[model samples]
Target chain A: MDLYSKEVMKHFRKPQNVGKIKNADGIGKVGNLRCGDIMYLYIKVAKDKKGKEIINDIKFETYGCTVAIANTSLLTTMVKGKTIEEAMKIKKDDLVKKFGGVPFIKIHCSLLAVDALAEAIYDYFKKIGRPISKELEERHEAAEKIGEELKKHHGGLFKVEEELHKEYEK
Target chain B: MQKRIYPHTTTRTENQRYFNRERRFLFGVGVYLDYAATTPVDPRVLKRMMPYFSKKFGNTMSLHSFGQEAKADLEESREEVANFIGAKLEEIIFTGSATESNNLALKGIALARRSSSGGGRHIVISQIEHPCIMESAKWLESQGFEITRMAVDKFGRINPEDINKAIKKETILVSIIHASNEIGTIQPIVEIGKICKEKGVYFHTDSSQSLGKIPIDVNLMNIDLLTASSHKMYGPKGAGLLYIRKGTKIEPILHGGGQESGLRSSTVNVAAILGFAEACRISKKEIKKEAERLQKLRDKLIRGILTRVPNSHLNGHPKMRLPNNANFWFEFIEGESIIIQLDLLGVAGSTGSACSSIKLEPSHVLLAIGLKHEQAHGSLRLSLGKWTTEKEINYVLKVLPGIIKNLRKISPFKA
Candidate 1:
């Protein structure tokens, strides 16, 4: 009957790599004061002798709840050896699903963790002077699509209101 | 290291169970766990109240036949309430709530003494007294009356000696809550009353959390004044009783056409009063068995949480606490976060005092019991009541540990 799975609790109780990484290739910090949850992720990404983009190390310092902590910890593990593009595509729903399912009200906490992970990957990309990854581009396109939908829904009313107001003034 | 899978299968099922259970629990499909806030109106009480709202509906003060019948019902309710508390019938005064009754008992007594005897301008109250009494004491202080707030132990219980030492010749009244709404710690009002009586000072207790849940013998306890609400005891919300011992004069707070022997002057709420009386009668007959049943459930809840949840501790007195009360604090987890998760799981409980839940500040009662800010913030109160069942308690036990564990994982404060 308990809401959380034993595995979620296990990871939560003993989080892997829970501190900061020094001399990291990518350092990402994400937060907004109004949101009340924040995370700082430090990742070491480099090519191994095999010339593969292997994650040498990952650590995070997060200010959030068990879900947030577990989500961030799981995120670090999930993205450790993946190419930067793969890491950037990680979604909030993915993080929540990994935790078995967060309460709907607290799905935001998981989102905060996912957002931090993306920021860290972006920071890594910036440090290397690379253009935005395909994942980042996809994220931007998704946001634009949402904005376009909103505009299409509401763009016409403003012009009509302005014309009507001018006629009333006249 | 093996790549941690993007979709952890076991974790998904756990989260599913947690969220699904929480959802099922909240929509009344889950156990109705919150009983102390207010109980479902007993069917008998509803039956008793029905006549007053319909054919028998009349103003008690009116001289007509219909009015006389209504007046008779009101007087009978007054007598029933008085008898329940072992007080004289004339001493009982009706109010809108226990909060109002508390205000009348403290303010009326203080103002009356200040105006009449021109002495005894000091009042002593326990640190854990309901805000109704505590705030009234503060108001009295602003009016030049000295107030002494005695401290309680970590169990949220005041010692008799502390109360005795706090008392002085200038102390006009000593007001304490018979049972705390948060931790459910029952104070030794009898001992406090004895000390006040010995010192020739009036003693009042806010029994809002105790009446109908426990036996209260005002005469045996030497209680000069007592306050309780009908809603707390399975009656309607808009009715309450203030028992002022006969010959203990207090100035009326509300002045109008003389009613309640000029102590309180308001049109009677006939149906509610009748309901209140009926509730009292039912509680008087069933409280002992009800208390035992609730205690078993409360004990199960406490033991289950402590055993299953790491770093969880009980919040109130072990034995002296209310039979229906169980409060716990799980470290590193936010109480609201856990409550939300529990809500998803379908359990209905509270983080702290229902009255203080809106404010972000930790409960004052929790603070009084010596909980640090962080510990207080992690608190949850589970109060059992008439409808609480063994199955519900077991379900809560099964569900809560996983919620706490899942929440602990995401908590920034987790050690």
Candidate 2:
């Protein structure tokens, strides 16, 4: 069976935000070569009305299959110009629903995209010396642990997708 | 290959221009470069096979004129297949697939030796054998047989000395593949076969990938048993052959209906056997001319990709590999992503990346060749077939650069 959906292909064919921001405020990197995927997300933060920190621009560099690249592309389009809280509220399921649906096996690609964004936020908060939420901190802790696990075992049987899948979604 | 030029020296032009180009299906007949996986059955072979389904649909085991007619046809096909490999008519035993034949060759000899030989329960095989051979050896290991997996050089060539050193008083069998299915590196079977013959050990070679592409002679190469597949050579899928030398010590693995002289037992597939025989006939006739023609195209494809696309290295032996195969691993980019983007431009190829396999691991053959995990993930295999045209190869050379460039831009690893 084909692993790509028409909606997914549309985004993969032309990822909207496909470059890095020069002098970006925050950068998040996730996934690894062993997983056959790696993602680096860059975000530019600016203060808006109500003194809120909003994402002015977001872009990503991804080395993965069609679904993973498309997930990051759709995510950049969805969260642009939104407050940090609003971007964090956008779950992987919402992004997956936007694509009609992805193959169940490839659902982890969306999870990587979502976690990459969250990690970017975590980086931004740490950079500004602001306190991170307990929930986001816990998520980062699990994500970081898996990243360590990926280092020790080079080619795992189940791979990081199933492990990350069991740990948490975005 | 004697002079390894570190391929990191490359120049990147403005890749932004390619992203704006029109994305349309550019070719009418999509370029099929995955011939190593399987080939479309030859129309002539199919034509010959059509009548067997209904008109000549008689069981070879039946006791009637219809049965005798089929039985005669079956023997004729077997004779043709045997002659193609330079074997006696009775030496060829048809099975369902190459995997089955491999299972039979490994287990049959191991089990036979276990029961007959005095406490000899050891076997030796190369590390780069197909999954069937590897798994069969693993199964035997679990059943109290000691197996030694011989390693290869960087070019995936096995040394005969390793085979000689691996042999022992208890070593009963040695199995190796004639050519690799993944990287297409041909082995020194004649040397290894001679080594086995000198030691009085049984030598079996899996020729599934090399039967039609190259020459094979069982007696001349000192091969005691060999395996060949049909679907890999433009024939039907359900037919494969195992050529066992007349005096080889072996026993049957499949005991049913006592077919194929009691070695392999099942109702014969008349149509597929006929098609296999015909395919082998055509391959024997055109092997020389087809190999030369393909070598020219293969060289062109390899040179064009290496010089045109920077940071790419050939996987197998530069000259000793198959004439129809060209494997490469580009720096910084993964293989499946490159395949997907190439498929978008109307080219079908395969890769060793984990994303493309059900087992979710990069090719073990690549790992055995001592490539880094990241390097192995970035491999692509483009194998040619009978219908592969010069124009199709040029199209691949034209489209592959942009795909690699785009994927590299997305990748974190830099060249």
Candidate 3:
């Protein structure tokens, strides 16, 4: 059975923002080989007219199924031109709603896209030394623990918290 | 191997040149390459089945003329299937499905023999029997029986010597699959059968995947029991058969109104059985020429994908595989992703790996062949059928290379 909506298929057929952005401000690399899904989400942050930091550009490279890739593609469109706090407000439910619906089995795909975006935002905060909210910090910590565990399977391809940080610094 | 950093140069093959994000993917008519899962019923079989459903439907054991007619046709159908497999009319027992047939074969013998004084309490099966057999063996173990799961080589082919060594004085039965459902590796059942015969153990091969595809002579091959499915061979779904060689001591798993010599005791679905018989009839007539046709097409697909796409490898016994099956796995990508992209382009295929399963595990069959978890996850099974045309194959060849290239781009792993 088709696990994605017509809208999801539309984006997945021609997923926008699929390539990597070099020297990006914040990059979120999440997922593991065990689940056979991973995403490299790149974001270029800029200030809008209100002098608030906004997602000027976003793109993703995801190793996943229909919903995972489609949601990642749709996610780029959802957060572009939105302020960091506003983009962070976007949740997995919002992505699912925007794409019509992702099956219950594939809810994790949308969750992964949400996690990738959140991780990118956290990375941006860390890169610029901005004060982070306690909730965001907790979620990031939890994601790191899961990512760290998943990393044991394939440490090379699945870049986790510390390794991803090291890569960005280099 | 070190992971290549981002912005690493990827040598684009000729196929990748066709990947234009701007040019819309040409959605062709749905091309089915997953015939192993199930086949649409043949029209001839359906026509033969129609009368049995409404007109000649009756319980085989009833005293009335309606019952007599159904009973006559049932035996005729049984004889036809029995003749196809070179087994006697009395040896064939009809069941609901292949799963049921396999369960009956494993558990029936285990139960019937456990009570006898000299009957052995050990069963030997291959490492890669269908889940039905595996679960039955596990259940038998819980009932205080010993099970020997013999291993297969890298190509998923079992060595007869290993089976010969694994059998014990207490071994009563040995079950192995004729051909693998996932990788299409055909086992050497004839030699295994001889070894079992020499050792005084019954040999049962699950021929659900190979029954109509390959010729079987149970007597010549020394097979004591065999299982065959209908839906897999362009017949109805509700019928399956177990060939219990005459004089084999096996008890019925399902006890109801005494049917089929009281082996499988249920009012038989007359229509499905007739349809299955007709399917066997047609398959017997066309098996030789069709096998040749499918073999050529299968090889074309295998060669096309391996050459067109880089970092792709074939699965299963490359030389000893089934005529219609071609299984492959590409590096640095998941099978579900490939299936979705193929589905969008109007092609149907299956993956050995099931990421969405509750356990989140790849196919055990692929893992048994010594593939890594990620390698197993990337495996795809493309099986051809009578309806598969050259045009459909050409369409797949045109699209598959690009699909692999596209998914590999997003895949984090490097070749």
Candidate 4:
């Protein structure tokens, strides 16, 4: 399948915010080593004058296919200036739509971006000892489960998507 | 031939500017380094095949003068191909493709032995064989034959002793690739063949990639059955040869018309066979000198890439490999990205990742050779051919390091 969309290709050719954020507030890493795709998301959370937490700066480092790299690039662009709450609401579908659309086979890549964002936000909340909501808690758990699943299938027989699908179904 | 032209609406200056912009977007003169995949038919072979299309077109089975002429050409071509491989003329059986020839060898031998009084039910093949052989082994498994896939070393070279250990009292045949298309590692066919011979089991080698690039004497190698594809050695596609030793008994895969001495039933593609014979003749004459030239180029490419690119490695055996092939694994960046970037520079090559499948999987060959999934996914195969020039190699050397650096810049792997 033509897994990479033209928009994805554009982002891949010129990815933005593709490094670590020093002394970052939160870090989220997701991937299957067997699938040869890994993405590390770094976010620097800042409290504005209103005392609202915002993702002031975000960066990513990815080793994967065109779709995986592009999704990370798009996710970073998406959450850079948004409040932590707003970033939590950014769904995988939104990421796919922002990049025109990815191939059906590559929807998991968009999900990876969402998972990284959720995990990062969860990390931020834990660091500050803030009360995490039920929704945020659920997202964090799902992202954590994905991380565990990826590690479990480090040298898996099934494809990455199949393993992830089974985990989501569970 | 018909000549055609399109009406142009742009002025000369506009046309020039447009072409310049287009050229900037496009890669340089298309450099094809995927010869292990296939190659363009040699013009000389094409020239010899022209008359057979219409002028001398006849069914070899017919009794007319036209049939006699076609028959004469077919026999002569068979003799040429046989001479090229040091086999007798009658030992060659023409098939549609290399894949077909492999099926005929593997299935044909297995089935033939199944019906025999003393024939066994076990077969042995290397883990790094082409898909055709692998699939054939799978089929044999369903047909109640015991199949053992021998493991290879890190260099993708299978040990002859491994074959010896894998062989059993019921082992009927052993088939392995003469040279690997992905990693370019040449198997120890002579030693393995001797093993199979000593064990009283038939030996088959798929020489689709190695036939013309290296020397092969079927009798000397003790190869009972050998497969060769025409297109891999500058011959036309749609024609391949299976060399069945004169006394080897094998069942026919196809069942009609009684062509190819009833071993293969379809009417022969006369023109394609002629082209294949011409290719074989030329390859036999040019192989030694050509191997020397391509070996120098292959070494230069391997050395340049390994030395220039950090964390880069050679995939196959260092010295005992095909003279035309050089495969590598670059750390950090995946192979698909490298291929796409190389395509932009007009360099055509291949990767070990089976990304084209329904599920993205690294090459089984690479995995069998002990490369981690991540390393296997980042593999590249640059296979040179007769048309590959030193200038093209230099161009690749000039542009490749820059592409690797750019890809590594965006990679998540720190190394």
- lDDT (Cα atoms) of all candidates against the true structure: 0.76, 0.84, 0.84, 0.84
Candidate 4 structure quality by residue, lDDT tens digits, B1-415: 0011112525666655544443334324777898998988876799899999889999898899998899899999999999998999899999999999999999999999999998899999989999999999998999899999999999999999999999999999999999998999999999999999999899999999999999999988999999999999989999999999988989999999999989999988999999999999888878888898899889999999999888899999999999999999987677877777787678888898634334677888999999877678788999998777677888999999998888777765542
Model 2 lDDT tens row, B96-163: 99999999999999988898839599999988999999999999999999999999888889999989
Tell me how large the interface RMSD of candidate 4 is: 7.0
Clashes (N, CA, C under 3 Å) per candidate: 21, 0, 0, 0
Point out the higher-scoring one by TM-score: 1 or 4: 4
- Once superposed on the true structure, which residue ranges of model 4 sit more than 4 Å away at CA? A1-5, A46-54, A83-107, A130-170, B1-28, B51-69, B354-358
Candidate 4 lDDT score relative to the true structure: 0.84
Against the native complex, each candidate's DockQ, computed on alpha carbons, is 0.06, 0.27, 0.30, 0.30
> What tens digits encode model 1's per-residue C-alpha lDDT throughout A1-170?
65466655666656777865556787655542222334667888988676767667888765444565667788888888776657767788887777788656557666766767666667777788879868765644553454345334323422443464355445
The local distance difference test score of model 3 is 0.84
Give DockQ: model 4: 0.30
Q: TM-score rank, highest first?
A: 2, 3, 4, 1
lDDT of 2: 0.84
| Model 1: CA > 4 A from native | A1-170, B1-28, B353-356
